[model samples]
Target: MALIITDECINCDVCEPECPNGAISQGDEIYVIEPDLCTECVGHFETSQCVEVCPVDCIITDPDNTETEEQLRAKYERITSDNG
Candidate 1:
């Protein structure tokens, strides 16, 4: 599943640079995650980096876009593929 930032987000800017997938971005106020690019750090870390760095625990799994480990890996590969 991808991650989503809730309204509890403090906009501390802590989770921005931690995302390996480049999914997190500044929105109107709080941060937002691009579900298409997010792979929950599947190919890069043991867990979600945004969650690790989030101060308000706003980043959580996006239930609406549930995905398996294999699917996450595929998404990661597609995003990082050099050959495209």
Candidate 2:
């Protein structure tokens, strides 16, 4: 599954830079995670970097995306491609 940022986010900015996919961003009052871009750090890291770095534990799985490992890899490829 992709990662999500809950309302509990303190806007502490801990999780933003840790996201290799650039899926995390600053929102109006807190941080947000882009489901389409979030890969749970599949190809880049062993686990969800945002979730680990979030100070308030506000980053959680985005149940709606529910991506498989292959799909996450595809997303990772796409993200890196765009980043280049």
Candidate 3:
């Protein structure tokens, strides 16, 4: 599943640079995760870097954008290929 930054986010600016897929960005109020680009770091790391670095634990899996591990892997490949 893609990750979501909830309203609880502190806007600490730590999560943005940790996203391997460049999915996290500054929103009007807090950070936002682009579902299409979020792979949970499947292709790049053992864990989601943003989640690892988030001091406030504001990032969470999006139930509204649920996806399987395989789907996330595929999405990661697609994103990398397009960018490559």
lDDT by residue for model 1 over 1-84, one digit each (tens)? 988999999999999899887899999988999999999999999999999988778899999989999999999999999436
lDDT of 3 at 51: 91
What is the per-residue lDDT of model 2 for residues 1-84, given as tens digits with 9 covering 90 to 100? 888888998888788889887788898888888888889999898888887877788777787879889999998998888888
Best by lDDT: 3
Ranking by lDDT: 3, 1, 2
TM-scores of all predicted structures: 0.94, 0.90, 0.98
Q: Of the candidates shown, which would achieve the greatest TM-score relative to the real structure?
A: 3
Q: Model 3: per-residue lDDT, tens digit, 1-84?
A: 999999999999999988988999999999999999999999899999999999989899999999999999999999999999
Point out where model 2 deviates above 4 Å.
Answer: none
| Root-mean-square deviation (CA) per prediction | 1.4, 1.2, 0.5
> Model 2 — TM-score against the truth?
0.90
Identify the superior model by lDDT, candidate 1 or candidate 3: 3
* lDDT comparison, 2 vs 3, better candidate: 3
Ranking of candidates on TM-score, top first = 3, 1, 2
lDDT of each: 0.91, 0.85, 0.94
